[model samples]
Target: MKIALTTSGENLEAPLDRRFGRAARFLLYDLKNRTFELIDNAQNLNAAQGAGIQAAETIVRAGADAVVSGHCGPKAFRVLQAAGVAIYNCEAATIAEALELLKDGKLQPAAAADVEGHW
Candidate 1:
């Protein structure tokens, strides 16, 4: 599975970013190949509005099967859901920890957006 993790840095050891739309980076981890691809989110990070929607579009374009983030805003959440990408909550955790939770099936797919737009 390809899991998109909102992170502060490019590596698995990086701390998870609490804000999905404004996250500094998104580490795309391919479980099947055990590889990581760094995606710089500088554009969305500075957006005055619609950052969440932009970020969601980026994830979808990257072919992410799921997203692991601390929080997902309504617009982004809706976009992800429409794209069939699962959303998982992984606040205050490292990328590695988040992956473990996903592997163990401990992370649940979010049924609804956890936060409002521009959150």
Candidate 2:
């Protein structure tokens, strides 16, 4: 399965970015292939509105099966849900740790948006 993790850096060791929509980058990891791709999110970092929606679109376009992030806003949540991409909230310190928690089934799918949209 492919998982997209919101992060501040390009590698697995990077600290998890708590803000999903304005995250510095997204590390898309393919578990089966053990490969990863880093996608920069600079464009959305300073977006006045709709950052979450744009971020959700990015994840969908990247073909991610799930998204691991600290929080999900209403607009983003709906977008991801509509696209069939599961959203999991994690407080893990690092991207790699979050992946482990997911692998161990410790991470649970979010039931609803955890944060209000900025717009």
Candidate 3:
């Protein structure tokens, strides 16, 4: 499974960005091969509107099977859901920590958007 994590930097040790739409970067981790790749999110970070939707599209394009982030807004949540990509909440944790929690089945799949758009 490929899991996408919203982060403040380029690596797994980076802090988790609480806001998915404005995250500085996204780390895509392949569970099968234990490899990771960085996805730049600079455009969405400065977007005046529709950041969530744009970020969601980026993730979809990168082929993420799931997402781990602090919060997911309505627009992004809907896009991901429609694409059959799962979303998980992982607030206040580093990318590495979040992955561990996910692997351990501790992170819960978000049933709905946790925050409103433009949050």
Candidate 4:
């Protein structure tokens, strides 16, 4: 399985970026091979009204089976689900920490988002 984690830098010690759409980099780990790679989030971070849809697309294209992050918007979450990728809920501060949680099955899918205020 390939898993992506929102990260702030190129190393595993880098803290997790809470803002999914605007994250700095995505650390991808291939469970089968035990290898790590970084997926740059430049485009999504610079997009107007970025809502994570692009991020999800990037992850899907990179062949990730799941994504771990602090939060994700509704549209992107749905897109990821449609792409057959699972979402892992977490507030991890580093790549290693996120991977540890996942290895321990400590992360769970977050509930779907609902409106919290009127427009």
Candidate 5:
């Protein structure tokens, strides 16, 4: 599965960014292949509006099967849902720990957006 994790750096050890839309970066990790790619989200960091929507589009374009973040907003949640991508909430300190939770089947899919837009 391709899991997109909100992060502040390029590697798995990077701290997880709590805000999905404004996250500094996204780590696209392939669970089966055990490989990863880093996506720059600097463009959306300062977006006056529609950051969530744009971020969601970026994830979709990156072919993420799921997203693991501290929180997801309504707009992003809807876009992801429409694309058949699952959203998971993880408060793990690092991206690596979040990956572990996913591998251990401890992370659960989010049923709805957890925070308001611009959060």
Candidate 6:
């Protein structure tokens, strides 16, 4: 499966970004192939500006089946949930570390959005 992780740096050991859409870099990792692909998130740099919905759409366009991030906002959370792409919350930064959680079955599936404006 293709997974997206918000990272603080280009390094695999870099901490996972708590903010989803506004993360510095978006790392696209393939579980079956055991490979890593880097995506630049220069366009979406402000998580609090309410860019989560657009960010989620971008991830989906980037071929990600799942998104693992430290935190996300209501807008993006709702978009992802509606799109059927699984979300894992509060995971460590970097695709490598996040993969560890997925392997150990430590990552939890995200629940429905707690927002009122979702449609």
Clashing pairs in 6: 15-93, 16-93, 52-76
Estimate the TM-score for candidate 6.
Answer: 0.84
- Report the poorest 10 consecutive residues by lDDT, candidate 1: 89-98
Each model's Cα RMSD: 0.8, 1.1, 0.8, 2.7, 0.6, 3.4
Q: Go through the candidates in order and give each one's C-alpha lDDT.
A: 0.91, 0.94, 0.92, 0.81, 0.94, 0.77
Looking at model 2, residue 47 earns an lDDT score of 95
**TM-score of each model, paired residue for residue:** 0.97, 0.97, 0.97, 0.89, 0.98, 0.84
lDDT of 6 at 14: 77
Per-residue C-alpha lDDT of model 4 across residues 1-119, encoded as one tens digit per residue: 99989988887788887767678889999988989999998877667764487888888999999988877777777888898888887877788898899999998876673322110
Find the number of clashing residue pairs for candidate 5: 0
Candidate 3 segments whose C-alpha is farther than 4 A from its true place? none
Question: Runs in model 2 with CA error above 4 Å?
Answer: none
Please provide, for model 3 over 70-115, each residue's C-alpha lDDT reduced to its tens digit, 9 standing for 90 to 100.
Answer: 9999999999999999999886568889999999999889999999
- Name the top TM-score candidate: 5
Per residue, candidate 5 scores C-alpha lDDT tens digits across 46-103 of: 8999999999999999999999999999999999999999999999999999999999
Which window of ten consecutive residues has the lowest lDDT sum in model 4? 110-119
Worst 10 residues of 5 by lDDT: 110-119
Model 1, C-alpha of 62: deviation from truth (Å): 0.6
Clash pairs, candidate 4, are none
- Candidate 5 regions exceeding 4 Å error are none
Candidate 2, residues 71-94, lDDT tens digits: the string is 999999999999999999999999
